[model samples]
Target: MGERTRLKRILRGLERRYGKIEPPPKRKGLPLIVATILSQNTTDLTAIRAYEALLERFPPARRSRPRRNLPRDSDGRIDKIKIRMVHVADARGEPNWRAIEKAPLSVVRNCLRVCGLAETKTRALRSLLKALRKETGGYSLERFLAGCDTDQALDKLSALPGIGVKTAAVTLAEGFGADLCPVDTHVHRVSGRLGVVSPSGGRNGTFRELRKILPPGTAHAFHHLFLSHGRAVCTARRPKCDSCPIRPDCERRGLEEV
Candidate 1:
């Protein structure tokens, strides 16, 4: 069978093993922008925690206060008031995008310190918001990019601060349902070991090449499957190649033994 056919089989095995991989609900464009930024050089769980913390602190409040009907969590207490004021020292008003855009760099730095590289990420968020404001007259990306094609959106988003092919791909795929695939560290390594892409191709090149080879309408699921497979079976240090579901298809290119 051909490599593309083997890829399809691998994808099928991943689906059966892990079920369908869907972007979580409520993850629109703006939040995804921040989440993707926070996700760099960190565990997904840590990135998720940082993202929720960011949203919980900001809450997209139309005014200084969070929504009146905002529900309390398992901890109990509808503390939107407190959450809203958590960044009062740094934010001019509430912890919303407007506040972030106008807030002094130090305040924005404090707000994002939970995630690593607070200084860099804070500037990126502010810069991204500034760009959105220019594009849509305010904080709206999904609506602005609604009519844009995958390549167009990719090009635009990749131009943003701290954004590149991988980050843009995550945002475009989850937010706009774009068909482009993202290539991260695990995907790069696994792809090289499988002969799916050249070992020297690099993440950006792998992304370009993978897009041409992967089956249509499969990029989103394929990205997550590669991630899961990288974490579980084909780990970097000592891959469980013998038990890997796609071992038959993998070329084991650089593998010392299996």
Candidate 2:
């Protein structure tokens, strides 16, 4: 069978075990961005708690920075450096852009502390939202993307502070239903070991190669299968390869314990 056919067969095998793949009822656009940020290095439960806390702090009519150029001394050395004046405000209606843009840094940090790297995440959240405001004249992520071409959309999303290629690709796949998949640790490691995708070029390269080899509209399901299988059968360590449904297709199967 062709590689794409093998991929489809793999998906079918996993689906029989894991059932359907469905994303949760997430708040699209801005909220989706926040959730992705919160899930950076934390567990789902921890991230959810932190996200909920943020919502409590910045409610409706509210919700949710300017950079100053540094002046150098005559020596062209750092004599006096200006601190970035973090802007803050209180929202009146709902947790909206106006509220997030005006909220103080401390509040945003505290709200997301449980997710770890609160300070960094808070800054990213603010930076993206502010960028959105500048681009759209308001906070409409869908509209912003709808107007931009695929490459343009990916570039803008990738340029965001906390958004890496994986996150940006995930956003496109999950949020916009694009025919692409994001490779997380599970997907990357599993793909590498499966010998389906090359081990070089890291996760980004794997994403590219997988996109080329896999059939259209199957990237998301392929990603989901790798994730579920990676966790349950073909794990990074102590994998249950003997019990795997697709072991015959796994070139490096059980190499985890070797």
Candidate 3:
């Protein structure tokens, strides 16, 4: 069969096996953004822990004036106040750059330390915030998103001191629900294993290859699906091939049988 046909078959199989792909929980601004930054070169659970620890140290609302039900967005989306506490408790919040930028570097670094690689991520985040402020006149998430197109936004973000293709893509895909794939280690590895791309190159190559095959508007969903499946089944070490729904269609490019 042709590559296109094979890819289609594999995607269909994945859909059948995984069912509907669920969008990751929409996080509040600061915590989720911080979590994404901490997620670099770290496990998700560790990132979550670091995120929680940071929030605990810098709770959104003090004990005296506990956060109450803030007004939701016009679309009925819950306001930041209501969800900020949940993010503090569990480290699952929206992407709030304003809150994160206002946080002290020491506090940010300490929070990130819980996940390991604290020093590196802390520097990166500091640089990112500084760059944002310099470029945008202020680090306003809504304003930034409104100012740039997809490519422009990605370029601007990647130009930041610590941000790279993956980080920039994450900001677009997760922060704005853009139709782009943030090819992290898991997505890169799993895509190669499933024969979506060659195994010889790195994540960027895999992203380029997949972009040619995937539909324009489907990249966001595709990224989430591949990521979720990679975590659940197509793990880096000893992927559960038997349990994988797409196994029958996976070419198993560079991977061994489970």
Top model number, lDDT: 1
Q: Write the per-residue lDDT of candidate 3 for residues 113-158, one digit (tens) a residue.
A: 8788787888877776666576668755546557678788878767
lDDT of candidate 1 over 1-258, digit per residue (tens): 487898898889878875787653333577566667776776654554565555566656554532233334467853331221112212222237786688688876775677678888877888898998988997888866767898988888888888778888877776677776788887887777888888697899899999989988888788877876777677888888877777777888337354
Full-model lDDT, candidate 2: 0.69
Ranking by lDDT: 1, 2, 3
Worst 10 residues of 2 by lDDT: 82-91
Candidate 2 runs further than 4 Å off: 22-27, 61-95
lDDT of 2 by residue, 1-258 (tens): 587777777778888876766642233556655676777776545665676677677766522311222334588742221110000011111255567778898988898899898988888889888888888888878877877765677788988898877767766766677678778777888888878899897989998888888887788777777876776677777888888888777888767665
The residue-level lDDT of candidate 2 at 70 comes to 33
How many clashing pairs in candidate 1?
Answer: 0
Per-model CA lDDT versus the true structure? 0.70, 0.69, 0.66
